[model samples]
Target: MRRKHTLAATAVAGILTVALGTSAAQAEVAADCGPGGPGEFANHTLLVFPGSHQPIYDFVNSAKRSIDLTMYELDDTTMEADLIAAVQRGVDVRVILDGRVGPGSKYYQPGYDKLKAGGVNVVWSNPAYYFTHQKTLTVDDRESLVMTGNLDSYYYNSDRDYALFDANPLDVRAIGQTFDADFADQAVTPSAGSGDLVWSPTTSEDRILDVINGAHRTLLVEQEEMYDTDVINALIAAAQRGVQVKLAIIEECDLYPYLNQLLAAGVQISLNNTSTDTLYSHAKVFVADYGQWDERAEVGSINISNTSLNENRELGVILDAFGPRNQQVLDTLDSVITGDFNDGQTYVATTDPSCG
Candidate 1:
């Protein structure tokens, strides 16, 4: 029997349910999928582009089977043409974007419009001002590909951004939740397979903070932008209470005015050494002392930046798993956090009562 887990009541308040139609027999885990190495992507074919305008022609031409393209926008010539062509072929195509149908957007409802016209389901999940800054593609759901950078044409042609691919079982219920939610929810209604996947302009910040504050011990963070004094204070309290607190950051993220405020208050933080270029540790991950059990250890992309946390929309997956999977996921992230990452220069919060 396929058991169901009830997330915090907050997540279930308004979210709908999915009837698992695809059988468990279809789950084929490509051992290659995961981090660092070319993780498993479940599609037979994928063309990862960077930015709002990644190469579209090749993406279009490469559609040998059903495919899903993820990007923030789609206004590039090659992209438009490929999307148009794919729809005509009755390819089961879908798109997820950061913006909705409005002015000043690169590809709003137009992309959604054409896809729907071509019989493809499209969804947008960017929170308020924070652009939904994620680019991912899954072909046949049998293979999945998640990229760190956007797929714009110039970046592809210019050979910018990195792309990784691996195989994975498409039949998993939680993973399918990602695909299902992409189409079910409109721009306003956010859906989460497991509440672990935080989507914003909704309750992302609150839920994340709740998760952080609720932690019993050990909090490690690698944030490019840190502004909320409440979060800083919470971490400080955690530290004071003897919960190991460590923050790894890169100082040039544009939220410095507030970051400096935190710095002046004396928050112990470690800064990454990017040398000439700005230290770019753009991966957003958080792993607490919460021992993984029942697949609750999650790791995905949602940075603690102004855009990621409050202003721009963001997407992240909490890789919840059973004891084994949870251990693997949690241990890997913890290693990355506590290892040579902080370099001893991280800012530490002041012990003043106000700093609390």
Candidate 2:
């Protein structure tokens, strides 16, 4: 069990995104990573999900090797069905279901019992005050599908939801470490909660804001959901301080009621919604100072609210956004807020305004 590289870390949430451009400055020519292509999913050995990915669990059936499923709560029809089929074929399946899958909600107890009876390795994580909200699955640590939307049977078209499946090893390892850490610890603390993210959350929120506050050029963000006042305030400060701060949020429904407060705070806010496209813009990410000033950073997923911060579970990864490989990621992520979506669908404020 004690193997190479002990995973000491964690996952991301909604709006399936395929990032396209991000660099440090015009001074620094953008590093062109190769075309986007997925490595074989079969190459991945570890399969983990942050919260739930029941709808797409069927994709894992493509794997021919080992599969590990982490669930604070199971009984999702998609998971149950997939696991049953996999186990029947002698696939090595282990599930860590939440301890409270019975006598409560609609966590299909019959299915839960069946999985247990069938010898599926399962863990019951109860006494949980916070949610184990991770929905990720890794394949051999070679290919990864880190996503924001849950794998439930929601009436999802590409708009109300989004998930990203990439075959980049750098991205894979980062995501892999996250899963390893979550499953390693009986208690799962995300690498990044809702609004706050980065290497250390000892003062997680404060530390991250400190980094963002110092940015000189641009700050572009695309989060599936957000409602953190502290984060929004810090961003507003940066914008007022002359840093271009632009944010992309789910339209009308400011997941965090306090978000409107940022508009008046000078944080240029944009809605990632279309006129008739009232789908859930569930992807969360932030890209800053690519090819400008002297900083480059990108990160997010279901991060930016007390629910994800303290109530629900979540994850985030910040790469050297300037890395040659991350250009597309930087561009696509930034465009979500400033490109076509920015057409007259933004709110700009002069101070921290209140949303009623």
Candidate 3:
């Protein structure tokens, strides 16, 4: 039995329930999933991409004391102006820009230079790490905005992605420490299986595998890239144990090999190809034992790759069945897997073809 926590009625009213199998009204976690009350899940705002920039800007605009942000990309001038305005208003704003070579590098000089010139304390990420791919914005060391996508306009306005705003003390403190370590270019050991926020290079892989293996009934996943062998093996092991596993990813040629393996193991795989459809998936999330009494969900910038898991700086949150955010994640998964948006191609196990 899960431990129960008491939450205000207003907080309980904010829960996002998973509506599936029937076009019925929104369900509450207290009535649907676990023994715990709505307080079991942290109160957080879920931001779906495509014109979700305003909420992000609004969060940044609300910073009162300080703002510490680390992003893989920043091409949007709207966010830039907000940062500048925050600095001008006597807020201590610090930014860590990715120095590694990539698309964001193109905007470093143009998008970020003006802020540095205007007195914002901006610096490039440590050269030792693969990439600072974590997208986080901490305000007043109390609230945090974690994301599965970049801060670029194209990602917020055009790409399929999501963001999470959390005020959980444990999550806020853990994420703040990680950012401080990265900004100082000092080695930092991330917390192992913290309450909500899970960090890479320490806890992400093992914790994520736990979620995948914990699923006694269902596992739903949506990721941008999938090449991590350990995660693949975990999913295969789960399916062999009779767990219903489903994957919906934006089809990339490199993922075909891994998708084939999962399909061979009875894991349902769907690849969204633009050649035939318009829905492209960019959200990185995992739902364990979905809709079950002990459903667990994770969403963040962490990707299933060796670099993302071990080399790059990444963050994600774990939401239990006690809240609406997890249900919202399930809602998104339902839409993709049920073909509500795009008609995805389902892959089946087949013999390896010869190049000759």
TM-score per candidate: 0.56, 0.64, 0.82
lDDT of 2: 0.49
RMSD of 2: 10.1
Instruction: Tell me how far the alpha carbon of residue 156 in candidate 1 is from the true structure, in angstroms, after superposition.
Output: 10
lDDT of 2 by residue, 80-116 (tens): 7677677777767665443433324453356567777
lDDT of 3 by residue, 1-356 (tens): 00022211001012222322321132232122133122222456565554435556766776778899998777788889999999999999999988764324455567678778878898888776777878898877767778887876654433556677676766778778878888989898865324777787678898798899888998888777788999999999999999988887876655678888898898887766456654566668888876678888788888888888877778888888565455665565555445513366665554444411
Ranking 1 against 2 by lDDT, winner = 2
lDDT (C-alpha, whole model) for all candidates:
0.46, 0.49, 0.70
Go through the candidates in order and give the C-alpha RMSD of each one to the true structure. 12.0, 10.1, 9.8
Query: Each candidate: how many clashes?
Result: 49, 59, 1
Model 3 clash count equals 1
Q: Could you tell me how far off, in angstroms, the CA of residue 298 lies in candidate 3 after the best superposition?
A: 1.3
Looking at candidate 2, the ten consecutive residues that score lowest on lDDT are 1-10
Candidate 1 least-lDDT 10 residues: 8-17
